[model samples]
Target: MTGADEALARDALRCGELTILGRIRSASNTTFLCEAAWSDRIVHCVYKPVAGEQPLWDFPDGTLAGREVGSYLVSAALGWNIVPHTIIREGPAGPGMLQLWVDQPGDTDDTEPDGPDLVDICPPGSVPPGYLSVLRAYDYAGNDVTLVHADDPRLRRMAVFDVIVNNADRKGGHILAGVDGRVYGVDHGVSLHVQDKLRTVLWGWAGKPIDDETLESIADLGEQLAGPLAEQLREHITPAEVAALRRRVRTLLAEPVMPGPDRHRPIPWPAF
Candidate 1:
């Protein structure tokens, strides 16, 4: 969607009357698939209520809904549209997060035969030509498999965004290949912690030099965080978390290199 269209959609999500359609059973939290209507516009969205949030030992301060919105704000500031248009509003279950639903390329089977798989597991030594190998392990059937993700620029941008947000749960399923030909990332409820909690399956570009354009975007993001964006983020995360976010941006600017996995658990469980 164009910038204007995205703005309109965000407004719709903010003002629309929400009706819970059904429960997204696959989600760990109590999430609902809902329809939002405002004026003459209608859109599908996901709603996650704070009351249903499962408490985490590490991130015990803010609500997950707020963190999701915070992640969207950072993505919007970067002008990458990596996260879908998202907002916080009262829903059928009280206050919660509402995000525009992105249609994936293969919504039925989660496989796009005519398109590239942004992240996948395949037999050893069968990584796609343009894909990067991440891990080698044995599947449940005792067969050797390799975890890999496509070496696409859009996905690379998302990896950088994950770093800026300190996203702790960027599972393979969280990366969506939208039918609009844009790659989008979802499920940011576990992001923006005060500590370095980055975890993801997209370790393909680890230690590589970030491109010039992305560095420019990160620089712009740092400027935004110092001004209005910082104030906006404070509504969701703590002052310390926002300051840590600024430090992460500045550190990346100084280093200009992607970081490799440094934690004991660098990738999330059930990679897909």
Candidate 2:
């Protein structure tokens, strides 16, 4: 999206008429499929109100919205459009996280049910070429089904971003692909915790050496987190969390390698 497009989108989110379309239920907050309108333009957005968030044991309550924005800021500082255009603003239900819904190019044409990790993904004897089956399950009628995913490089990039943010719930369903071959990641409210709770499904590039370009990006972000990015992030998350982000940047730069899974838990629940 262009700068003008992003500005307009944010304006629509901040000042347009917000109409709640419906509800989107997940593991945490009460999500909504909403639309905001302004002068002949209508933008669909994901709305998560503060009042609807479920309290967590590790992370603070009512701060998920801020974390969502923080994730975007980190991605922006890295110079990668991994997350969508997100903003924190007031809505009808009170202040919350409002993210512009991204359109997946040719997304409606994706008849294939394939990705990195999941259970009971497709029907038996229907695995596509170059795809591998990882798990199996039974359909509701007791019919057999198999889970499969293809090796997409987009996921590898996402994995790197997730590690940088300490994303705790990188479920398969959060990954979205575009017709331009660019993948956009969503649902970042459970991320940036000041802990080692990095659970995700994009472990394909584990232990891989960091490329020069990616390393440069990491170094650039580290500098920003210590400077301007730190100022922007302090508006949303705790000062300690921002410090944790800087620490994560330094750790990744020093190690310069993809990390293995945590000993306790490496993947999110309901993986999709």
TM-score of each: 0.96, 0.84
Supply candidate 1's per-residue lDDT for 241: 96
154-217: candidate 1 lDDT, tens digit per residue: 9999999999999999999999878789999999999999889999999999999999999999
Query: Best lDDT goes to which candidate?
Result: 1
Residues 39-113 of candidate 2 have per-residue lDDT tens digits of 767888999998888888898733898889999998888888888878888887988899988777454675664
Runs of candidate 2 with Cα error greater than 4 angstroms are: 1-4, 105-150
Clash list (residue pairs), candidate 1: none
Q: How big is the positional error of residue 65 in model 2, measured in Å on the Cα after superposition?
A: 0.7
Cα lDDT for residue 85, candidate 1: 83
lDDT of each: 0.92, 0.79
TM-score of 2: 0.84
